[model samples]
Target: MISKIYTIIKGTGKYIPHLRVKNEDFLNNTFYDTYGKKGEKSNQEITEKFEEITTITERRHVSKDLVTSDIAFFAAEDAIISSKIDKEKLDYIIVAHNFGDVKHDNRKSDLVPSLAARVKHKLKIQNPNCIAYDLPFGCPGWLQATIQADYYIKSGDAKQILVIGADVLSRISDPHDRDSMLYADGAGAVILEGKESDTPIGILAHTTRSDTYQFSEMLYMDTSFNPDSEHKDALFLKMNGRKLYQYALTTVPQAIQACLEKSKTPLSEIKKVLIHQANGKMDDAILKRLYALYDIKELPKDIMPMTISWLGNSSVATVPTLLDLILKDELKPHKINAGDSIVFASVGAGMNINAMVYKM
Candidate 1:
């Protein structure tokens, strides 16, 4: 008889950078519009507009001395400690990040040594048997990694795995671009262990898709922001907020529904919907649409937990960090219990959308 191996989220951890950047901090800086000319909008006007649209009051940025891998190690160590799992026992370490230790000011990235390998080294895992790699799937990267971990566990190929999502998008953000207000730096991680279970108690189902045809160009970074400079150092992140908003409203709800269908779990049984913290309003729209698909008129107030107001958008790190905070009871309005159905969803840069259904 084939024994069923379940991938259980044994513990969670997160690290938010020490530098807290509030909206008012941008008031003194001059910004440029899409054109090369200085922006006509005043600093107050820009900050107010950004806050009104995204509902982001502040975000955390990594200090100049630290990098993405540093924060990832911190979060990973915490996860290992909380999980009570031995460092030498880790079977695999998967890291989700867009830029590997890129400087916030330079937009340069180092891919020579994989970020996951660096994390493993920093944690001082003497186990040469531990496999490590990096995954770059935009903002949905972390959830996607979890789905992969589930596969490894069910296949009995691994006993324990460390999944981490860390990003320093702030370094690639263009201060002149309004989207800069929405970017931040942080890392979140979870330790998943394979355990024998008769009943289904872990990741149930998942779906990941890309809409590169219509939305790939909606969010991107390039050096073309400065028409006057051909130098490679001018790269910065930018986004078509309107296009992303519409894309999330139309596609994210359907993605969640599809994921739920695969899990064979009823909508009413879901205790919480942890979504990527890209924009507060966009997330609410996604939630409402999800409810509409279920033919439920009223959206539950606490069903979808949000941290964008404080954390901003850390790209792939948002959902995991939010999940960690909720698990630790840092977020009062949200909680997860055994026998609960939880849905995780995210949409971001690649114009990618993914969802996973997990039963606890």
Candidate 2:
């Protein structure tokens, strides 16, 4: 019998911030338009309308005492303990994030040592050969890191790899911008190991694209919309929400189509789609468009389990965190069984979009 190495998930874990932020909490925020004008609508009207569109009733934010690296280490520890794998034997510690460790008081991104190195240190790994790195390709960083890990495992250079996605978006969000309510904080990690098999199982095929020429600034950072603020230099996460929604709807489905064609997996076999929880409405449109590519009108029920309504957008952490929740039976009625094919995808800053198909 012939055997081929395949990348498979050994264990998964997530750190969902205990701090739950409800939509009503933002009713007192003084939101402003892009032109520095105060919001015209009443705060109640604004919050209600925002919830109607984004379907986000609540989100999570890290505690005041914690930073990005701390949550990354927590999630990584959960994955290690769940897998019962030797932390010292890890081949790579890949952390995906945009802003580094952001402090509540300072609000400045700290990337001196790289979040991966920080996590490796906090984990107390002693292996000198275990490579640590960071991938900052916007929100798709975690999935992209997994794609890179697959390459090393396939080449026989690595047998075990730890990939984490985390971000403290609340620290970087502008309270004056309505989009601030859409951001959150959390971390999720997974351990990937190479297993010999006769057929493809994990990470069957994936595709990625960057549309920086015209769409790079769809989501960016800028000073607070409040012109009177004392901190003029502090940067906050900003977005052209309409343009970003359109851009995602235009491109994400195409990438998923390319992945499906590459894997040659029929649409009917895809049991689930774990996508970055950027926006609930936008995600619904993406799923519909994906099915439309195959010329199918009706969509499957519960095919895409979402935490965005409650978890908000934690950038890189969304997909991996959602994956962990389902893997642990915390997300009910959505389960992955052996041989079930699933699609994972995301779209975010860098104007980037990516998709991967995995068979469990």
Candidate 1 matches the true fold with a TM-score of 0.96
Q: Each candidate: how many clashes?
A: 2, 0
Instruction: Give lDDT for model 1.
Output: 0.88
TM-scores of the candidates in the order shown: 0.96, 0.99
Q: For residues 1-360, write the lDDT of model 1, one tens digit per residue.
A: 455777889999999888999999988765766776777778899899889888999999998988899999999998998899888999999999998888644557887699999999999998998999999988999998988898988898899999999999888887666778899999999999988877887888999999998788887877644455544466677888887899899999999999998889989989899999999988888899999998999976699988999989998889889999999999996899889899999998788899998888
Candidate 2 residue-wise lDDT, 1-360, digit = tens: 589899999999999999999999998899888889998899899889989999999999999999999999999999999899999999999999999999999988999899999999999998999999999999999999999999999999999999999999999999999999999999999999999998888989999999999999988889999998777999998899999998899899999989988999988999999999999999999999989988999999999999999999999999999999998999998898889999999998988899999999
Q: Relative to the true structure, how large is the alpha-carbon lDDT of every model?
A: 0.88, 0.94
lDDT of model 2 at position 304: 95
